[model samples]
Target: MVKPATAADGRWDADPLLGLVAGCYVAAAVAPPVVFAGDAGLSLAAGGLYGLLLGTVLAVTAVVWVAVARARSLVVRLGRSRARWLLAVAPVGYALGGFALLGQTGIAGVLAFFAGLGAALLGIALAAMAHTRYVAATVDEASVEWDGRTGWPERARRRWRRGAWVVIGVTAVGFAVGVLTDRWWLRVAAQALFAGGVGFAQTGQERRYVCTEAGVEQRLPVARRLFGWATFDGYTRTDEAFVLHRPWRTDLRFAVADIDDPEVLADVLRRHLD
Candidate 1:
């Protein structure tokens, strides 16, 4: 279990699981580049051997880094922002996907395929575990002011309803066309559109939210998000909700009516924003 952030310094306990996940991410990120470098080095007489040796050293370094308590602490500190932590791992996914494509058509292809699949599955598991642990720790340790469920604003819900219909229509048409034309890519696109339509259809569903001194926790239908005070620059109040603004990311909207004490929530936000 992860430890909550201490009130004194606001630092969380360095959980070993966090360190292990970080180390695995580091290894995944290093592997593809190292393999490419080794391939490139084959042109030189001894460059391939050198590249292999360098890769081994880096791999060992990642393992040792995970073993150190201070290093784990640093990783835990950095991962405090769940959004940032997840974003950091995105490149690993891209790298693994690219490697899988590059090595297609041989034993190398099979290895890359399994590697990518395993990494993706492992990443999901690690993220879920870390998020659960941190949220539990936060709730246990922090002063929670309000905890309840909220729905999207009526206006937003209406917009999503319209959008969902359009998406579903397009998906149906696309699928029909793909079937007639026998195009695999078009079928894939239609499937993606259908998935998106499902998301749009769920827009007005009620979601749980927790307001605490540390941050706001949003438990949406598909995922749980913890938005720490540090993640947002400021917020704007609407008739129905308070919108937390962040740079280059979607803003978080908390329904004011759904919260029991608006003034207390406002004060809590003010203390953090100020």
Candidate 2:
């Protein structure tokens, strides 16, 4: 559950401006795409009209976004902001599924697929920023303690790290096979394998933190593990980043790099300590 920040808690990951932009995205996704193909016949003029209509809709969406951001609470505002991106991503999935069902495979299909992919990627980037703000605000630096108990699940997770390397090794083999075979299906499978391998490799690193934060917790596999918990003191807010802090914790900064609501995290830490 996310912790709620009181008025006293420092604002973290709060982006009223971004929230407005995100709201516009949500509106755009919900609105109908301009329809140029009709009984009147599709022409350059019709296409131009379609574009003009779409642009107008987008402009209206922007206005609505601003209104919504101004009206909602910070947490609600952030949630709506993220929802906008998620809404934007839905179209990509729809396009992919539709094209696959239509048996459309070729340069055109690939181009269309990639176009959707690009939009999806952009949405993901926005969502990631929102997520960072959310986590930073909700998870306090102090709450993440290194007591001494190593639970069974944690041990199991640690043991699973061994499999991560194996997965990576297998992925490499698949990639080689796919390239040699020159089969389209094989190529896709190989890429999937490689991606999965990378995922597992990262998971293996995460396991390092699973070793209960007891005395001398295990260090990350290498010095370059970038996603470890930072002391609250290390966190800072920027115009681009979500900033959260608590007035009571003067010694620590407890800022999360890219959360949507740092206030929630601060509140969580505060309650846990109290």
Query: lDDT per prediction?
Result: 0.63, 0.44
Native-referenced Cα lDDT, model 2: 0.44
RMSD of 2: 13.1
lDDT of 2 by residue, 14-37 (tens): 345555545544433433223222
The window of 10 residues in a row where model 2 has the poorest summed lDDT is 207-216
After superposing candidate 2, which stretches have Cα over 4 Å from the reference?
1-41, 45-92, 101-112, 136-162, 175-182, 204-274
Among these predicted structures, which one has the highest TM-score?
1
Q: For residues 1-274, could you state the per-residue lDDT of candidate 1 as single tens digits?
A: 3464454322223455555565565565455445554555544335664566456546754574446334433334434555644633565556456655664433234334454555655566556655654565555434777677877677777887898989999999999999999997698689869978987797666688777776788775544567777789998888898777999976776677777777776777787876
TM-score of the candidate numbered 2?
A: 0.42
Clashing pairs in 1: none
Number of backbone-clashing residue pairs for each candidate, in the order shown:
0, 24
